[model samples]
Target: MRGYVAMTAQEVAEFMASGLFDVSDVYAPTSQFIVDHQDLDDEEIEYTLSMVAAEDALEMKTATSGAACVLAFEVPAESISESHDMSISLSSPLKWESLECLFEVSSDGEELTWYATQEIDANLASWLK
Candidate 1:
């Protein structure tokens, strides 16, 4: 965690232009493990997932086949306040996972809040982990 080089968007954009943050690699879905970080408890994972990727500005993948996929987001806009919009998708090849989000991040980058129907598989138990 301490090794990551966090930079301002301007610096990041410059690096991106220079191929520092390879866009393809940055977003590539992988199981090719980096530092297999210690497992984070459900409560420790702070996230906002209320919208769909196809419809909402942001979307969260529902858990499937016991695996979950969600978007790692950044609030880059300035006009949004209180609440905004998003689109959540619950899709997976696993067939057992249903990804759900507790809420959404406001456009202005406030804390998390969400819509009502943002759960993947309600039947999935807490014992799976």
Candidate 2:
């Protein structure tokens, strides 16, 4: 399944350096999310949800003090378990085997810029410099 994770820029760099990635929380397109966003097409819904998750990630980073980013990755379907709420949790930490995309959410209301997995390192380097 495809999911979005909230990650710090440091975390992203570490994952790239070490080839490992793990996080307890992931946001996905749950049934409730579909119901809440009935007006959008499937692609639109997914994009909308991803942006919402990205915004939330920024808030989390603010509380902890770091640069916030969102990672879009594909994981085994069985690895994820949906919670009673809208979010989902992973069974275990994931390796770098399935990352697909990345997003930079610098602040609220700004458009998010997406980066492909292959483009991440260069983008991160530029962002850091």
The residue-by-residue lDDT of candidate 2 on 42-119, one tens digit each, is 899768767877777777774434467888888777777655245678887777778988888866636778888889
User: Model 1, range 5-92, lDDT digits (tens) per residue?
Assistant: 1122232224324532322111111122222323633233222121222123222222322212222323222311222122111121
TM-score of 1: 0.23
Query: How does each model score on TM-score?
Result: 0.23, 0.82
lDDT at 99, model 2: 90
Best by TM-score: 2
The local distance difference test score of each candidate is: 0.24, 0.75
Off by over 4 Å in 1: 1-35, 46-102, 118-129
Please report the candidate that would top lDDT against the real structure. Answer: 2
